[model samples]
Target chain A: MKTLIAIKEQYHTWVHEAFPAMHPLLLPLCNKPFIEYLIDFAILAGSREVRLLSDGQLTEVEEHCGTGSRWGIELSYANLHPADDQQQLLDKNRKFCGGGRTMILTGYNFISYNKQKSYLDLATIATDTPIASCPGGTITLKGPPESGASEKSPLAPFSITPLDSVQSYFRISMETLQTGSSRYVLPGYGSEPDCSIGKNVIISKTAQIRKPVSIGDNVQILPKTIIGPSAIIGSNVVIDNGCSVSGSIIIDNTYIGENLEIDMRIAAGNTLIDPTSGVSLTMEDPHLLVGIKTWATTAILKRKTIHALAATILLVLQFIPFILLFPLLKLQGKWKDDPYMQETGLAGALAVAISLDRFPLLLKVITGKLDIIGSSSRSTCAGKHSYPDSGPLSRLAVFSYAEAEDWPVNGSDAAIVERFHAVHSTPIKDIGMTIKALINRLTKGR
Target chain B: MAFRLDTLNGITVGIAELNGRLVAENSTILQKTCSDWQQKTPFLVFDCSNLDFIDSSGLGTIVGCLRKALEKNGDIKLAGLNAKVAMVFELTKAKKLFSIFSNAGEAAASFAASPVSSKTQ
Candidate 1:
């Protein structure tokens, strides 16, 4: 017996737009993809060969499935026209479907079935009639009529639901993650119900799994994090720690950061989103963390324009201060030379008096290597020593928010205070904060 | 910032009611305005029954006000934080910094019952 699965461009478009690098068929529902469910359904139905047909670009699907060698089944991919009907589809693939018994699974619908049940045997020997489907596609059977077979219960418990929106998508995934692989033949193993993991996953011990969750394969859950009761983390993802993920679906290849809260949202690639509302927010700030944007297109000129504008302003602002304070600080031996010192955690931080040390750093900000009001730049050494939750915004600034507020200059509390300002502070606000910092320094006479 | 100084059971407790968004736009105004209120009565309660949002700056200002009150040997408590603003405090771990009450009246009354500090001592 052979199986025919067909998906069209109209349905595939959502997959491509939602997941750029991954194939829609391979996109996991729960921790499994919609297509894998079809494959599992085909394998159960006593089919040795499954042919996938789509009107969209099937290259991604082909690369992913690849003859289905892993499942020990002959899987082949083909394309159909946009206007092809069911009869036309059958005629076009007559050779593949020539076997007297054929089970046709079509459309972008999500088929919900139990792996433990023998639904395939039931479909083969009991139902002789073709199963007509709705708008999302339906399951139909053809070939020859079955011999005197007892009437069987309708496939009510195992229903195929269509995923039309992001809300449904999030719900389905969260449900699957919580259910785990034992209930659904999931790809990975975690022995715990809180973790429904997929195939080929890499989990670090330092990373904390709170359970009642589902995780996909080829995933890296980084250190010092909490993942939850209703979390669906997709495959090929990196969840960096000091982060808390609860009631969320983190789509593939998404990079979450330390001390970040991803609650009630679906983070697909670089897009931080509210999936239920379909509100996609592209975070311009990368230091906090970011997902990878699938499209490589960018306007280089826009960046250059902003940098040039910033440079002109900085050069003008720093002229008098740079010349006057440089020699004075150097003469006092207060201007210490530390190369890439910011990354060494908060300790590698150099304490500069007032507005004196900001002269050089301002140039870095204009060059775009530094954000004028962005995260304080951390030194490489400091980054290594700092704990996952240890103030993620530890990169020291010549003028810190804590300094402006007369708080302790170089402690964890100071780092937290500064980081909060760094994340919320904008360029316009930076100008105001910088002035306040200068005034504070002048009044303190430090 | 609407502040009311009341004496309950011979204890002076100042209740400062905050309305709308306590954000950077007017967080400083709260600080400057609340300074006089802090001086009038050391024990205080910030009634956040109508507060909808609070950014980091607003949070800082509140912390600053708390510090000022503490310096005068008294304390400031929070009351009636809505879910959204409460979420911000929880995320930043600032929820631990205050003695939160269910309502402003409760917070104000708690101060009178406790008499935060002995004025004569």
Candidate 2:
């Protein structure tokens, strides 16, 4: 049997806005994308090939699911006009629907089916028409001709529900987490009924696990953490120490800090969210935690350009001063080299006072390898640190707010100020901050 | 800084009416002003009838006030919280911490109907 999975534009519109970076079908329902359920259902129904039809961009979906080889089914993608109806969909993809019993699963709504039953047999014996569906979509059977019964029995009949609102989204996730398994075939693994675990999962012995939990692959649940009752943890996730996750779904590649009370929320990447109300909060403060997006190519290019310009300007402006002061300072024993400090510490008071230590780094900024003004270039030894991107900071500047504003060096407050400036500071802001830093340095006799 | 206070019966219920916005700049001001107001009665009502918005920091400060009031063997109840403010409170589960009422008069009367004993050490 062949399956045509057709999703309407209305579905894509909601999913696109609901999850901008994520694919709609792949939007996780209890740590598993919504599409996986549909795919699993199609496979269970004995579909040898499945064609996904949508008006929206399917690049992300295609990238994720590929050719459906993982599920041992042929997966193909096609585009549909917003006005296209069921007949139009079939006409457009006549070749794919060739001469066989075709099951058209249309709409953005979710299908509910059990994997345990032999749906392939049911497909053969069941009436040659749409068997069941909600108002949002339907599952109809269409094909040229079929032989007699090929193992005829109704599959475990299930109800397909539409995930329309944030409330429904939350409810579905919570229910799935609570049930630990869905009426449909779900991804991941479970040694027991209540827990569905995925690959490369690491649960610290110190962590507490309550039943009805779903954890995806490469997940690290740290010490003193409690997960469950209703929790869905996705792939490549890290839950730090002393945190509690109940009635929540942590999406892929998300890092949750220690002591965070995440309840009835969805932590997707860096955004802490409430799915019930569809109200998401980009955590403004770092101790609360923030999302860190991998630097995009555009950002890298922009950073490099700014760095190079800043480096060039600094090299030119400081040329005369460096040439004149170097020999004199060296002769006066004030310019003595400190290799030890360079190796073990950031520059000393002498370099800071002279403002010489920052000069070379400023050049690196122009080359686009470093921020003109950024986080203190210090590695985080411990704890969560937040940099504000939602606010005014643009992440490209020299002489961070921490230095110019005289925030205490290397402390939490300073860290906050620097992070705020680093993320918010733009190229124009860099000029202003650089001037402030220079003025402060000169006024302080440094 | 417009506010109102009334005592319904012997319960000594005081209502502080908040209007406009409650944010970081004025959140501290609210806390300081509420401290003095808290002295008038252990059980107080904040009539948020006109309160329109509240952020996380502002919500934190209010929760802090609750902790302070609870510490002093007193209680602070909320009345007429608008949808936006209520949402913020509910999202943080801060709503669970306070006794919420439909109106200021109802909240003030509630304090008299059931006087709370001190659980605070």
Choose the strongest candidate by lDDT. 2
Model 1: CA > 4 A from native: A122-135, A146-157, A192-207, A217-223, A292-446, B1-121
In candidate 2, position B118 carries an lDDT of 31
Q: Write the per-residue lDDT of candidate 1 for residues A1-446, one digit (tens) a residue.
A: 67899887576556555555456777777766778878887887667899999875565578778899989999998889979977888898989977467778778877666776666444445465446455777777766644433456444245666666666677777666655354466766666556667777777787777767878777787778788757888777788767788888888767775577777877776566566666555443354336644432343335334534654575686687667655755666556554221222222122233344566766665565554443344422332232222222333444456656676545555556665675576555666766676677556653
Any runs in candidate 2 off by more than 4 Å, and if so which? Answer: A122-128, A151-158, A178-185, A200-202, A236-242, A253-283, A292-446, B10-12, B19-21, B36-43, B67-73, B82-97, B114-121
lDDT (Cα, tens digit) per residue for candidate 2, span B1-121: 5556665566676788888878777899988888887777667788899987776677788788888888878888889987556655654557778888889888888777777733322
lDDT digits (tens) for residues A289-349 of candidate 2: 4454544678667656765676677778777766665565556555545311231122234
Give the total clashing residue pairs for model 1.
23
Q: Candidate 2: deviation at residue A412, Å?
A: 46
At residue A380, candidate 1 shows an lDDT of 23
Model 2 chain A — which ten-residue stretch has the worst lDDT?
A338-347
